[model samples]
Target chain A: MVAFIGQLGRNVIHAIAKLGDASIFAVSTLRLLFATPWQGKHFVMQLYAVGVGSLIIIIITGAFTGMVLALQGYHMLVKVGTEALLGSAVALSLIRELGPVLAALMFVGRAGSSITAEIGIMRVTEQMDALEMMAVNPQARVMLTRIVACAIALPLLVGIFDVVGLAAGYLVGVEMLGVNSGVYIGETIDKIALTDVYAGLTKSMYFGLLVGIICTYMGQRATPTTEGVAKATTQAVMICSVMVLVLDYIITSFYL
Target chain B: MIKTKGLTKTYGNVAALNDINLHIKGGEVTVILGGSGSGKTTLLRLLAGLESPTSGSIMFSGEDLAKISRKRLYELRLRVGMLFQYSALLNSLTVYENVAFPLREHTDLDKEVIHTMVTMKLEQVGLRGFEEMMPSQLSGGMAKRVAFARALAMDPQVVFFDEPTSGLDPISAGVISSLIHETTVKTRMTSVVVTHDVQAGLDIADHVILLWQGEIIAEGKSNTIKNSDDPRVQQFIEGRPNGPIPFSRSQTAYVDDLTHKPGCVRLE
Candidate 1:
């Protein structure tokens, strides 16, 4: 029992130390945003990598998720004789909840893991140390640009996800299931408030920041070995996915 | 010029380097010779300010590197250069871009000027026509040469090399050692090299420091190191396995390890 308690305490302290390192890294890197030499080239590269690179996956996932949600909603609503409400149901869920959550999750798998691997490999290969020797601040050049790019890109990508998802829901519910097309389109317009979008985009923006910080932190602290880079990549993806789901719940509670 | 006073570095309770006092003269090639795990690379890293010393100071140009503020040290590093064992070229960039990276980053020089400078550095390193090739396409020696060009991009006053000859053929290694000798003579840059290859170290080094178990065991001119009477030094240089530095560094006896002694843990 004493040994077990000691082990537990050691793990707790390790966890706290890791948390502190990550917080310091994020805050210091973000502080570079206000500095001069605005890193325009690097920022644009990251937007291409994190935003444009993940475009197709996000669209495909959005369409399929909306179609599935609509199918499930139609069965349950038809039982209560309120099947006409399917459009509003799908719109509210996609706009207020699923859009941001699923988009963030997809971003984790698509971009976040690749960022971690690329940075982690650079760390392992001593390229980061080489950069430091050349007096290039890797934080400003690598971390700051990536974090800001993800923050900007996530909201824009989530907007696309919401639009595509709602359109897919419309295709399945009105065009195929024979629900009134006008009711489908009108209910979607009537049900979703601008505030719902603000909330979802807000959640996505925060998820973007969280993914950026966690992935970069893991990569930056990688142990400088092949297995180390692989582990950091896996940890980045897993942690970003889990955090997106958990934060989605917490932010949704605020809306409620 | 660079100097260290009783410099030491520790990871957990084990010291990687200990009580190292040395001075490297300006515009000279100094080779730090040691076997693996003797902390030569650790000392190089400390001098580069990549890792802080646990105790003592690294003095360069009247400033204590150990005590310098982080921001100040980064600024100071602009005058320093490093060539890694693996060459550490930015794999994503072409040869021209990699060599031009430091200049493009730190200077407001026009693209034309940067282009001229990159061309000159690459030409100096004998890689004049390989400008558009990626690092992945280069041979080991070629990659190392490109890295030398990159290290020279800023015309740094000092350059540290970590095991530059490790993964090369004998001819390539000789070419690199001669290149180091020629570069230092031409540029007047202080050079610190870490390597276990005694022949390579002796070929180029004007000054040599031999590290054993984290401490400076012997240091002098390269010939002095070659002729040293110390059995440990002889053991390393002559490649005799049975001597002061044993092959297996395991603290525990094999039996104790198998029997699970208090401090002995099984290998992962």
Candidate 2:
């Protein structure tokens, strides 16, 4: 028991130290992000990769999620004789929770994992060292571009997801199930405030920043080996997914 | 001109480099020779400002590297260039872009000037027509040539080559060695090369330093290194199996291991 406790303490301390290091890395990158000689090309390329590359997955996830929510909510509302509330339920869920959380999760799986792998490969191949030798700031050139791109991309992606999901919900609830199109549209608009949309956007922005930082940090700190790169990529995806869920809960609890 | 004073680097309790002092002259090829794990690469990395020493100081043209700010260090680095063991070209970039990258990032030169410089450097490395090719399509020798072209793109005053001939055929190694020699002579740039190849080191070096167990065991003209009295130096250069440097790193008794099974065996 004593040995186990000692090992546990050591592990906890190690984790805390790693977290501190990552925080410092993020702070330094942000401080150098706007320094002279901006990397406009890299930023634009990353924006295309993280945002445009992720569009198809986001659309599919949004559409299917809305359909499922409407199907389930229609059954419950019918039983309660409150079928008119179906639109309110679907819109509230899509805007307030599902859109941001699910979009962020998918981003973590797709863009975040690839970013980690790419950076890890750079480290393994000595390309990062090469950059340093050339007197180029790797943090500014690599991390800052990707992070800003992600931050800009996530909110737009969340908006798309929310819009697509709402449309799908309308198709299922109003057109297919005959829930009354006018009532559904009117109830959804009445129930959703501007603040809910703002809240979801805010959540997505934070998620994007966290995922970018964590993935880049993992990749930069990864050991220079094939196995090490693979491990870092997996860790980036796993940690970002968990962080998105946890942060979503915290933000929702406070904002709602 | 570069010099080190009592330079030491340690990883935890184990020292990768011990207290050592040396001078690297200007406008000459200086070769650092060592067996594996002899801290040759570590010394090169420290000189290139890629790593900081645990203790002691590195003076590059009279500026102390350790005391300088990151910005100043970066400025200092712009005057230096290095070729990595594996070429280290940006895999995402085409050959033309790889050589043109430093020029694009560090200078305000117009596109025409940049293109001319890239073409000239590639031609110097004998890859003039291979500009649009991706790094993945190039052979190992071609990749190293491209990396060399990239290293020279900034017209640095000093160039460091870390195992330039490693992972290449003998003819390719000879070509790389001749290129290093010709480039250094033509540009009159200070060149530092780290290698284990005895013949290549002797053939191209104006000065040579041999490292053993994180310490400089020999330092003099390359020709003199062959006749050195140090058993370690002789063992290394002559490639002898029996010498002060043990071939096998087993500390346990050989007979005891054979007769009775030990609790655990450590492999180095």
Candidate 3:
């Protein structure tokens, strides 16, 4: 039991060291960000790939989730003679918690895993070393692009999620659930101030940056072995997922 | 010119390289010969600044590598090109894009100039018209030639080859060796190749250094190596099993064990 405690302490220290290393990586990433124009093209392309590619899923999931929340909230509120408060409940959940966090989590799994695998394979195959030899900074072109792309992309994705989710809730509550259309739409509009929407967007931005930086760092440091790329890809996805959840909690407590 | 002093690299308790001191001059093809565990790749990586030496200094044109910033190191790297043993071509890029990659990154050259240079390099390596093919589509020799063309794309002053001719047929190997000779003459470049192919070294090297047990045991020009009196050198060049380096058994131990069989347990 003592040995186990010691091992756990050692592991915690190692993790803290890794986090410190990650902070240094962010510095290098900043250097890469300012150094090359290749980063511009790469950033735009990765943004398009991550944001546009995931558009359908984000919209569908947002719409259905909103509809289900509205249906349930209205039905439950009617039993308590407070069905008119349904709009605030759906809008609150969508803006304060669900929209940005869920969308960011989904993008991490989709975009972050691919970036990790691609970069890991590049490292193992010596393409990264070849880039260094060629006087081309791989970090600038690869990592910076992904980070900036995600920073731009995740907010836009969250906007899509927010508006689509709101629209879906409005439709279900007004047209299908027999709530007065004007009251449902007006109450939602009144409850969702700029602060709510902007806060969600801000959370999305942080999540996007987090996902890109962590995934790229893991990929670049992958071991040069046959299984290393696969392992990096898996670890990137797992870590990004957990980080998105944790950040969601922190942002929710702060913002909401 | 490149030089290393007391270059040592240790992995935990194991010394991959031990106090290696060497000088390589301009306009020479120096081959470093060694087996798998002999630290040839580690030496190259240390000089290339991909890995730092545990203790030593690497000086290129009198510039201390440790003192230079990464940007300056990158500038220095523009003068050095390395072709990996596996021909590390970017899979997503075609041969043309791969070769043109360095030029595009480092130079202000427009697309027209890059195209012209890429074509010229491909033609130099006799890989013309394969520019559109991906690295996965190329044969091993073809891939190696493509890698060579990419290395030559920047017209680097010093080129390093990590087993450039590893998987090629004899004919292709000859082409590559001659191409190295031709490119070096055409560009007056310094070339360093690490390989265990003794015949290839003999055929192309202006100078050769043999690495054993993390140290250089022999070094000379090709002709000097062939006629050298050192027994280990002779054993290596002649591909002999019996010499200073025993094949599978030490001579004293083998004789003693032979004499001390159960029937003749008392050799004395």
Candidate 4:
């Protein structure tokens, strides 16, 4: 027990040191990012990848989620004949909880994995060192662009997901469950406050920043081996997902 | 011009480098020859200001390297090109992009000017037509050539090679050595190469420093190292195992003699 406690304490210290290192790296990178000139083509390419390329997955996930929630809510609320509340409940849940969180989580799997693997491979090949030698800051040219792109795109993507998800729920509530279209839409619009939308968008922004930093951090810090890249990719996805969930809770609590 | 004063690096109980001092003068090829783990790379990293030295000062052109801010160091680094052991080409970029990367980053040259500059650099390294090729598509020698092209893009005052001839065929090694000599002379760039290939080093280095056990065992002209009376120097130059360097058996035999046991059984 004593040995275990000692090890735990050491680990905590190490984790704090690592966090400090990451913050320094992030701040230095941000400084360079703001100083560099923005290239339109590169920014557009990254934005398209982060935004448009993610559309199909977000829509599919959001639509299915809405349909399933309506099916389940019908059974639960029918006991009190308050089935009409299903649209408002689904809209509130999607906008305030599911839309941003789910989209961010999905992005962590796709884009976050890409960032980690790309950076890890660059480290293994000494390409990042090469960039440094060339006076081309990799953090600014590569990582910062990805971060900014994600930050701008995640909110847009989440907004789209929320709209689609609510619409799907509306269709299920009215056409499938025989709930009144006017009543469902009216309740959804009235009950779901504008603050909820703002909170969701804010959460997406934070999630985007977290994903960008964590992915780049793990990738750049990867060891000089093949197995190290795989480990970094896995760790990046896992950590980003957990962070998204945790941030979601905090944001939810703030709004509530 | 680069100089180091009393540089030392210790890892726990092991001293990787011990209070060593050296000077690399202008417009000459200086080769540091050492076996693996002999602090050759540690010395290079210190000179490059990549890692902070434990207790020494590195002076580059009379400016203390340790005191140089990261921004100034970056400018200094731009003046120095280093060919990494692994070539270190960006994998996603084509040969042209990799070579043009430095020019693109530091200068506001138009695309046409960048193109011309990249072409000139590639031609200098004999990689002109290979601009379209990806790093993965190139062989070891070709990859090194592309890396050289990239390094030359900034027209640096000095170039460092980390084991340039390592892991190459004899012909490829010879070609690389010639290229190093030609490029340094053509560009008027000071070259510092770290190599275990004694013959290759002798062929290119105007001056040579033979490092052994984290110290400069020998330092002189190439011809002087070949004729040095030092037995360790003799062994290293000739690639012989039986000189001042004792093999693994010698230590074990001395220990056994102290214990009065020729061949002891296993403790278990």
Best by lDDT: 2
Candidate 2: which stretches are off by over 4 Å? Answer: B262-268
TM-score of 2: 0.97
Off by over 4 Å in 4: A31-53, A170-180, B246-268
To one decimal place, how large is model 2's interface RMSD in Å? 0.6
Model 1 ranges off by over 4 Å: B250-268
A93-183 per-residue lDDT for model 4 (tens digits): 8988888998898888877898889889988887777777776667877778877788888898899888888888877888998888888
Candidate 1's DockQ is: 0.79
Overall local distance difference test of candidate 3: 0.86
Ranking by lDDT: 2, 1, 3, 4
The worst-scoring run of ten residues by lDDT in candidate 4 chain B lies at B247-256
TM-score of each: 0.94, 0.97, 0.90, 0.90
User: How close to the true structure is residue B103 of candidate 2, measured as C-alpha lDDT?
Assistant: 91
Question: lDDT scores for all predictions?
Answer: 0.91, 0.93, 0.86, 0.85
Error of 3 at B170 (Å): 4.1
User: Model 3, B93-112: lDDT tens per residue?
Assistant: 89999999888877899899
Interface RMSD of each: 0.8, 0.6, 0.8, 1.1
Local accuracy of candidate 4 as per-residue lDDT tens digits, B4-46: 9998877777888888899998888999998887889877777
Instruction: Indicate the worst ten consecutive residues by lDDT in candidate 1 chain B.
Output: B259-268
Clashing pairs in 2: none
